[model samples]
Target chain A: MTEADHETVRSGLETHLPRLWRYGLSLSRNPSVAEELVQATCLRALERQSQFRTGTNLRAWLFTILSSIWKNQLRAEKVRTGGGFADPETELVFDGAASMETNNLLRRVLSEVSELPEAQRQAVILVYVEEFTYREAAHILEVPIGTIMSRLSAARGKLAGLDSSATNARKTRADEVGKN
Target chain B: MVSAGMADHPRDEDLVAYLDGELALADRQALDQALSDSADLRARLEVLRGGDRPFRESFDLLLDAAPLERMRAALPDPTISASVISTTQTPPIPANDWRSLGIAAMLLLAIGIGFAVGFGTRSDMGDTALLAELDALEAELEEAEAAADAAPVATVKGWRQAVADYQVLFTTDSLTPDQGGDGALALASSQVGLNLDPATRAAAGLEFRRAQVLAFNSKPLVQLAYLGDDGVPVAFCIIASNKPEAGTQYEQRNGLGIVHWIIGGYGLMVIGDLPEERLNSIARDLRKSIQL
Candidate 1:
């Protein structure tokens, strides 16, 4: 690559690497796997640099690549393991001490989010965490906006239920503390 | 007047748009009014807005404790250099090893041919040639291994320099805009190291709508832009001191890319259509460069 091109790639890579890792982590729920995914994604991007449209959204393109790689890996693993899925409840167990005091409510909510079905989880993360627009998320997920809406709805309903339970539990605990 | 159940609590779809402020003015007004009147709805909105905070904070703490230098050492040396391509291209490998391997393979093939040719006349000659070919193959394998062990450090050095430059830029108050309007200009300057094409650079300038410098890790953190190549930026980057252990993360909403990373002693983000590779490369480079 020309010095300029190298600089461009380097700059772009530096700017986006963290987010890529995070996205990978969120999807794989493992740091090592996320790193591998990011590395593979970068190598692929480097190999197929010519395919990148100069003025296009580089992050989205990379994400598409990462998601495809991750999904493929998941599919391959599924084939190997006879299609068993992970338990959402187990994944939602958060360590209370690991969080800050101010974030107690937030942690409770996310744990509940983690319990959502895979589609709903993706929808919530994409909508809430990534903050993508409904149309844009639909494009990324290759589903209709309505599907995005419904998935989001399901996620929200589940999260709301979780939040209500958490709040109730907290209130009960507070009352007990007051009586003591 | 609508009854309690029918008072328009904002459907899930509308809530998403409302959170992103993508709703039309009329819708926004309605949603805002609803939020004012309904504590439960307001609380729910707050929960959604604050959903990722713990994750971000946890990731940030992890970054603080991570051994960044070790991570840098673990990274492969960049074989591709900047001074040579129209687009991204892999760096060419040294030819000496290939030449030796090729020569050995050819010698082995020739010896096999000789054995076949002499088999009727001299069996001893055939065995001798075969043995010599085997020795040559062994020698070739050793040479290949030795060559493989010696990686090009220049690429790693380049990556280091890029990271260092990013750290310096991120830490020094050189680019922080004094006012909000100047943030777009500041972002444009940050693009200098990125080496984007002029058109892409210009487009980035247009896409950057605002900038803010906030304190992170006792140093300034710059947050800028809402427009992205994806049509809107749902992402941002944070260039801060000391790399985050867990690294950066992204989520896309409404075609927006939200990116957050720590470079030097500051946090940075660039939310846009810019690809993840581009963002990652930049973040990694910055992380490697930041001093303390």
Candidate 2:
């Protein structure tokens, strides 16, 4: 590959390192594995930059690669354990110092999010936390937009029970009314 | 208390999509009209919106907490394909081998280090490193073929590396369970003079597939093929050796975890795409079963 090609893809993927790690941590729930995912994803993006479409969202492309890598590891872990899947929850929790859940609400939200089944958690994080449009999140996850929407609604069905942020919503609405 | 229009009745998916602004324009406008017309609808939408947990700000904490420096240090230098590995990938070798085995030992160490450094800094987390190693490994195949000819003169590590290379070729479909492996295991076990009881075959917690007598350096090397429950391939091999007796040693080789040791003039190994600790435990179980 040309050096210019290397610099373009390398820098683009590098800029998203922390974000990729965050995504990886969400998937694997392990910090070391997240770092491994980032390094592997960078090498892969550089090696296969040819496949990346120019002018498309590079961050989405990189997240897709990171997601692919994480899924493959889970598959390998599946094979390694024979038929049973290893529980990521018990082994390496990403929630230790890496989590800054300072308030009760944030901590509860995180706990509720983390408690979702693997697939729903992924959909929620990509669409909500990372703000991938449902379309882009679907592409990264290789699921249809309908599936993403259903996963999110399913997540919202559970999370919407959190004591409403009604006070904040009311204040914002009052301010809007006053401005109008 | 006005009845909601059937055309505008929103499902939970619509409420979430509305929150995300992901609906098409016409659909969004319909939801907007429905919301403005009904206080109950607006209140329902507000609760869903309230469910937002500052997701971006919260995850950014995780992002900031990433060990960026360490991870950055580990990122491959895009300039050189093999530089980081050449300097960093050192196989675990005992320190005193230079004293006893001399240049032959050193030659073995050099070869181990040479190839290990070529692509071995760390095991491939998945296919990225696997694809790269596949290319590097083909280049080494000829060297392994040459070693096959000189097998009598080959050291344990040299031939084991060859065996490890052969392992990279396995897929989930590489072998089937119980394809005349009993016969081969019987014959090869007899040839190698080890009593691998049927119980020993199952000791590794894997499904037995087949066994074969493979020649290395013109010496018969017995290979026992097996698969895990999910079709993860694993192999237990025995090759005759004249090396001094050694305790079980565990390591990762060419992306596979291997636990090997010398006993009764044979080098025995349990190799698989498993973690080192796993292979080590399997080896321990086999050793215990056999010694009994």
Candidate 3:
């Protein structure tokens, strides 16, 4: 693309960075990874600016780039190491929770959702949390609406099955030990 | 947690869609009525609702996830706001930035055009120097090429001896034909349509010491030489030949670098201890001053 076109697409992409970051966080579940993912998405969007129709949804276009990059990273990671999340403690490094109790609760929730399979977790985050319509989430994820619906349904089922009290008790005991 | 009582209850997808308001109006109305009648359906719906909170809370980090400024820095300056209320109205890049882009585009276009013209095809023979000069020049180049293979670059015979002798004459300020200062030197150079101007010498980090009109193979050659700021000798020779040429060829000897190229029907060669790039720059300057 010409530099002018690049600058234009860049400004267009700047408008979508926050949502892209959130979508990145949802996909990677790690702050640093999400940051890098958003950076890559912006770069890719700028590089391929010509592909973007000027008046189309820039947010959707950026999300599409982010989703594609994150998926490729996941695929490369999978090829390199057969796919896995980092240790949960590493993820905790960026928790920035308001209090110990909230931290525990947030971590519990995070762990539960993170443990869900990728498709289900993404479906839940994009639809329920991000509040995208099923169709919009489908477009972002590049899946059919039926796939989005079922994934969301399955995610809810898994999340509902987690015992919050048991998770809290576990965190409480771990905290007590740390204190000792 | 819906007790195994209600059949034909909305499937989980349908219920999730209902919660999402993704259900069609008629389907949503039917589920709303059925929900009021069946406690089990309400409980089932409640369980689905419970999952929504954690999912929302899990991603809520995003709500507070301030954009990392470094993310925006990847773009050009004057940051574009992430809240660009509408993408269609993307701010135009400033005009000067556009002008810079235009200049860069033109530069690349010029380079491409130059490459195509320089190497793409032979300029017609008529566009070259007369045939006899072409033959003589090619023969001289061929002989120099064969001699260069057997000798170190600085010690190449024929022209090397002439350049070395000229270097000595130039270093000792003993040039004949033109032995005066700036005015006389400029007069001599202008007479031959070339300049032995000190500004050019200064640009090449040398001080002009003398200019001479000499001959090689009965062809008039203008020899201009200088002493570098460090006292090493540098020299340039402009030859008036009827030789056609392709482009410049570079030869480096011991420490001296030589560049030879033809302008119109005259050949110009610069011999120096400077880098080949420096020699080429001087050659380009001289080429710029000459017209076919």
Docking class of 3: incorrect
Lowest lDDT block of 10, candidate 2 chain A: A83-92
**Residue A87 lDDT, candidate 2, scale 0-100:** 47
Cα lDDT tens digits for candidate 2, B115-223: 1111112323443444454445444544654565575453455667767766756655436323443255666667567776552365646777766555454455667
- Measured by lDDT, the strongest candidate is 2
lDDT of 3 by residue, A27-93 (tens): 6555545655666566456435667876666777787788886775443552343222344333422
- For candidate 1, give the docking quality class from DockQ: incorrect
Q: Work out the TM-score per prediction.
A: 0.43, 0.50, 0.47
How big is the positional error of residue B8 in model 1, measured in Å on the Cα after superposition? 7.9
Off by over 4 Å in 2: A73-104, A162-180, B1-6, B82-292
Show the colliding residue pairs in model 3: B153-B253, B154-B253, B154-B254
Best by DockQ: 2
Query: Per-prediction DockQ, in order?
Result: 0.06, 0.20, 0.14
Per residue, candidate 2 scores C-alpha lDDT tens digits across A124-172 of: 8998888889989999988888888867876776577743254345435
Instruction: Estimate the lDDT of model 3.
Output: 0.55
Give the residue spans of candidate 3 off by over 4 A.
Answer: A1-8, A78-85, A88-108, A162-180, B1-9, B54-58, B62-67, B77-292
10 residues in a row with least lDDT, candidate 3 chain B: B111-120
